[model samples]
Target: MVLVFLMVNAYRELTPIVISGRTIPLKTIRKAVFIFCFALTLILISIFLILFNQGNESSFLKVLFEVTSAFGTVGLTTGIAPHLSTFAGLVIILIMFIGRVGPLTMMVSFGFRKTRAIPQYPEEDIAVG
Candidate 1:
């Protein structure tokens, strides 16, 4: 379902949609992708670290499966969830909520609003390593 939403958003972004003499910009697509990737990375890393600290003795594959399952809200497990720590369980719940509601929807519900007018600032290049 998430993938379907992403694909649909991407298609809408690629194909221009004009209504009432104005082209509608699908800016949510970029925001959604960024939010999804950022959340996925953060969740994966945090879960991996938590599992590592718990000394579960489970292989990386099993941990990955559990995290992905939670993120996808698939309710599938590798029998390791029962042994996980409380903190890990909370993290799984967070991921499950994020998966079910979607990162974009969660952000929007949390008062993330898009402004009609964006203020542009002058660009300046700074020294970089």
Candidate 2:
């Protein structure tokens, strides 16, 4: 998704473009990239939280699987789900919630933003390809 945003921005910035047909807006790509990054960060944080708490109780791969399952909501585990600490369980729950509703959308629904009305300038035609 990040690559998509980069490529679209680059394409839009090219010289002597022609608008042959409808094209996706860069804003959508930017939002997708943002969501992808936020989900990646949340996954990493959740995995580390479980790993640090689990210690040598399980293999790293097992911890990773558990974390993935939690975020994926697949309801599968390597027999370690029963032994998760309270903190670890909470972390998994957080991951599940974000996974279900997405990080950015969740933040918006949670009132983490204030919409602003930006006045639009008069439309003008521009060449694109």
Candidate 3:
């Protein structure tokens, strides 16, 4: 699943840090976030197209709004739920689950826990406004 993929990726990237006490690569985190965001965008687009093509009398904007609302776990509706087909209702339920347990939280929960050792590096303060 998605969580497995994230754990593999995180383990590969964080192994050095966990074993050698090195910092995680920022670029790795950036790339992971970018990919996740792209996937989420694609899912939204697919939902929009399907809803719009249904010709169920709901406006495209309304469909988008409902999809977002469901995905965000926000119960607001533009008065279109009663007409949605069974499949669409199922999609909404899936979205609600995704919203409730954010993708990142679920993914990160798959990682193995690390134990801390005594600190070796001294703390230094950098000037900040």
Candidate 4:
């Protein structure tokens, strides 16, 4: 979240979220809020959908907690870990993989963009006094 704020504020050179050709302009605060909220909603929705299909009778909050645990790569569980279906286990594994690798991947992707180009201007630097 802090990094997202830095990206939206300090790192003004990078585009926030570009899809196809539609570049919706968003300010630093708005972009941060949007990203945070959207990601939370999406994660909750995916978790709920998967658990629902697995015929769960648990409340949404319980499922959300489980989903957060998986995403956070935490070992804690509400006694539901062993009973999950194979598909659900696989999904959790995949989420765990993402939780482990996602930040590294994000850094790499942020380092390289399809629209980036070599600087056309000459470089100059100030000397330390």
Best by lDDT: 2
Regions more than 4 Å wrong, model 4: 1-38, 103-112, 116-129
Candidate 1 lDDT trough over 10 residues, lowest sum: 1-10
Question: How would you encode candidate 1's per-residue C-alpha lDDT over 4-56 as one tens digit per residue?
Answer: 55576557764654545665556745675677686778677867775776785
Give the Cα lDDT of each candidate: 0.74, 0.75, 0.67, 0.64
1-129, model 3: which lDDT tens digit per residue?
334445775667634222244455656656566657844874586477557556766777887788778777778998888878777777777667766787665556775758789779988968765
Predicted candidate 2 versus true structure: per-residue lDDT over 1-129, tens digit per residue: 445546665777752222355454667656777777777788888888888987877677887888878777888889887788888888888888777776787867876666899999998978976
Q: Report how far residue 98 has shifted in candidate 2, in Å.
A: 1.8
* Steric overlap count per candidate: 0, 3, 0, 0
Distance (Å) between predicted and true CA of 54, model 1? 1.4
RMSD of each: 6.4, 6.5, 12.8, 12.8
lDDT of 3 at 2: 38
Best-to-worst order by lDDT is: 2, 1, 3, 4
Q: What is the lDDT of residue 89 in candidate 2?
A: 81
Kindly indicate the candidate among 1 and 2 with the higher TM-score.
Answer: 2
TM-score of decoy 2: 0.68
- Deviating ranges (above 4 Å) for candidate 3: 1-32, 35-39, 42-46, 106-129
